[model samples]
Target: LIITIFYSTDNPLNKSAITVPQRAVSTFDQQDLSINMHILKWKVTLEMIKDKPLFGSGIGTFKINYLDYQADFLQKNPGYIKYSGKAAEAHNEYLQMLAELGIPGFLVFLSIIFVFYSLALKYLKNKHNNQNRLIVFGLLMGITCFLIHCLFTFPFHVPVLGSTFFIFLGLSVVYIGGFGLSKVDTKKNIRIKLNLNYLIKKIIIILMFIVGIFLIYTLVFKPYFAEIHYFKGIKYYEKGNYNDALKDFKHAVWLAPYNGRILHALGSTYYHLDIQDEAQETLQRTKYYFNDRNIFRNLGLSYKQSGNYQEAEKEFKQAIYLDPNFTKAYIDLAYLYATQEDYDKAIIEWNKILEIEPNFSEKYNVLYFIGLTYQKKQMPDKALEYFLEALQLTPEGSPIIEEIEKEIYNIYKDRLNK
Candidate 1:
């Protein structure tokens, strides 16, 4: 301590060192100063555990279902919204296993690990096993390396890495048991009896094999074909080629009529094409088949376009309930409120976007919209505050900067006249 103090500065920190400016980096961007996203993901995983503590959401369903749980958490803890996204991994393998497999599976997994280490420790410490100790130690180290990697990453998800780890563990077990990892009594295992029942068993096995092949073709290969069209439709959709996207999606739907994902994309295309009736019709079909938040969001958009504000509001709320961390849904819902001339409600909704701005990408948009809403409510001072905030976030040489400056100038001019 004396040595450290001798080398370090004796000066105290000032306000400039203590406080960061909001102008350059908004509070939204600053929310994720470190690994907060991972922290948020683990919190969501805990919630998933509570919802289904026994069987879990299911093996490998973490990627498919974690978003809904995160959205629910964010709805109550709005401040954590900035740290939300579709994270594919929980960033902690132990937590992920507990979440996706439930308590029973988690305990079983832990037991396997515990037993392995217990046997390993016993084998390593045995003085009689000294000759093979070096090999066992090497293999154990390889497995341990992967185990350490699993603390911050899902190494098991990577086939090569996971296989390597298991190979190391198997080798360690083999080396630890110099006599062999397993033994079978040849005298007890070699007896075989042939009878009429043997022929019957062969025939049944052949039939079962054929049935399994048929099922694989129907469930796996059939969907494989639909996935081709589905991916083609996605590419077209991204290029803003709605007509091409619609054609491909229609073919995909024809191939896999019950595929909710494909159906949802089709519905969204119809909405973008201004066919509100077909959009609503198709989206409603998706509702029965899929539980995606995007489906509900598109349904709300279609309803709003059709002048059904009540239904639109309900659909948007449903979407938010499904995934509050989806920033677009809140923005759309706020715009819906703004269209109804409900300035206060619109501002409130827009402000929520500020609370959960992903990378502060929507900071300028939220501030500018709230400013306009305040202006509409005859609150010029509040409007100016938001406009100036938006201006501070604006990048140099952007056309929007001038627009914000114009709004600010107008507010000042009107105030001077008053």
Candidate 2:
């Protein structure tokens, strides 16, 4: 059971890996992605559980199959995709257990918890006559608190936190003498003895130790190492070192094959290097692990760069279909249209930004870009209208102020020349 769980949650995709829609009201200020959200987006998780209510989608398969379930849910309720974020773990641990292990497995899990508490109560009663009662009670309460926390978070999925849980459990087991106070434990200073009298017991202990080492190495160290490589790749990618980024991303993917975020990054880097075939192949592979608009947007960019305008248009539209309020996708789609010299369609797409009303900072860009688009179509009056509107919102002394004024001048100058 420990081995199975270790294999299951080895790595969780970063929450921001999913390109969720943001309200136009959110500040464009830089903020960390570690969202302190308590609400569990359990609809897709429930769907997965319903699909495999018996033994589950299989141990360690939730991350693998999560995207498919999300895709189906979004297809049926397209409007909900904007509200959805990528949940690498069902925030509710028990529901995740049910999703991964099914009803029977969930019940068995419940039974174990029930037994732990039942024994804890009994142990507490016996400990009342002992000096270590306070310590035992504290440990029990800590365990209880951790369990309640698990109902809303994935702390136990983290190695150090998870280890602390078992450490508490282990201390309790030692304090309770497995079930109750032992004869020796009745003494003031109770101590646990390691009695390996039987050959079988010795063999079992040895095997357990070996398994523990293997599990720690596989579950704890490997994922941590994978995260190191992934973040290093991100840093390199941001620094415009595509080769170094690709090298590290490949290392990350190799370390944790199931992590959708790592795969997505790798595909994106390929897209950046103008390796269209590799980019498409990698992003196509990424589709299997993550269901989000970002991958589609990236794919659209790859296709556009490769001169596949039709395919590029489809991918961008698909991204918009998945997340209507995703300003980046809307922008990308508008650019795609503009590239095809379909100014009307490009204007239509850019006009959708007005409907979205992205933040003040973003709105200015949208208006200015639309003005540019109109200018490209030789509609000076319409272009000037949008340009003036953009200028009104521009910051004092912003460099873009000059740019906008120049565009306005260009309109007047072009008309004079005519």
Candidate 3:
């Protein structure tokens, strides 16, 4: 079916108008097959975990058991395992709950879905009102889609997806419950009248207002606390207290896992402590969490410091890929090449830097390195040219000027003696 879809020919739907071509039809068929396979895997997964429908194995344990489960399944049913190499998940909502949380969790999960569906059905039957029905229908469809998608993807295990799913679930429950209650209340003699005691009414209103404000503050302004911790981490970083910096940054990232800067800071702190592996892992995680070019640069630096030159080069390139005009990446790449004695590659990187920022303040450093490279390559005259350029850029009595002058003197003296 997949092959037929991908290789199918297009035919005109009408004599006057264009239709989906055979190529498109084929592609669609292939895609349809892939989706079907995904759905089938999810179904099999659900059936496998049907017996363990309550209180799942435990939170975050599915992946560990997934391989073993797949191996056992493959051993018993070779036909099913032939299509896909391995099954990593049960792929069904109830199965995921059983594998991770255990039977109880699965039951609760199913109960939540059952209640939602029931409420949705009840709302549709009574609320013949179009607007309310539309709202309920939309909510029901959204929740249904969430469950269906969860079968193929571990959406419930992913932090963002899980949180979003639960939030939507809560919204669905509130709408369904509120709508049902409002309808029931309308038929009852429940008179919601204002109290004659003004003080009591004022107190109730104040309490409600306070509660509303607290909710807003907690959800909206609570992030500032994480930001405070981040800044404290920065202070610790500046003081070279890596352990404390790491702790604070970890807290900040824990509080705001999406913060790229915090992750980068944590990675850097780990790098300085000479924990190269940790630094690399943290920085990689940072990249996954955020797409900031600075993190790539920091990652490159960490790799360079750890003597992983190839990986460092890759990360520097990635940084440049993310931000072409990121001057620091160019400089770092040049320095990295220079450290490897690949003067030609180093020059190429430096030239790139010059192209991006013609009057880049670091030109002297590049010139000085170029001179050193030429000297290493046994081109004294060419090396002298770059040294002169570098010296011209340096201030009088600058250490760079002093160093270049000494080199020039030595070169000249050696040439004359020879």
TM-scores, one per candidate = 0.70, 0.70, 0.49
- Clashes in predicted model 2: 0
Model 3, poorest ten-residue lDDT window?
9-18
Q: Which model is ahead, 1 or 3, in terms of TM-score?
A: 1
Q: In model 2, where do residues sit more than 4 Å from their true spots?
A: 1-37, 58-84, 123-136, 177-229, 251-259, 290-292, 321-324, 375-380, 396-403, 410-418
- The residue-by-residue lDDT of candidate 3 on 1-418, one tens digit each, is 5544433434343342423464345444634655555554554455446534555556655543444444444455554432442344555555666667666666776887787788788878984679878988987888788887775566776679889988988887788777664545656768888756989889989999999998877666666877999999999999999899989998887777776668889888988998889899989987654556677788899899989999999988876654556788998998999899998898788778777777878788778878888887788998899899888988666778888998799789989999
Worst 10 residues of 1 by lDDT: 15-24
Location of the lowest summed lDDT over 10 successive residues in candidate 2: 23-32
TM-score of 2: 0.70
The list of candidate 1 runs beyond 4 A from truth reads: 1-34, 125-131, 163-182, 185-188, 191-194, 197-202, 218-220, 250-263, 275-293, 318-327, 351-418
| Model 1, CA-based lDDT | 0.82
CA RMSD for every model?
8.8, 10.5, 14.3
Per model, state how many residue pairs clash.
0, 0, 20
TM-score of 3: 0.49
Residue pairs with clashing backbones, model 2 = none
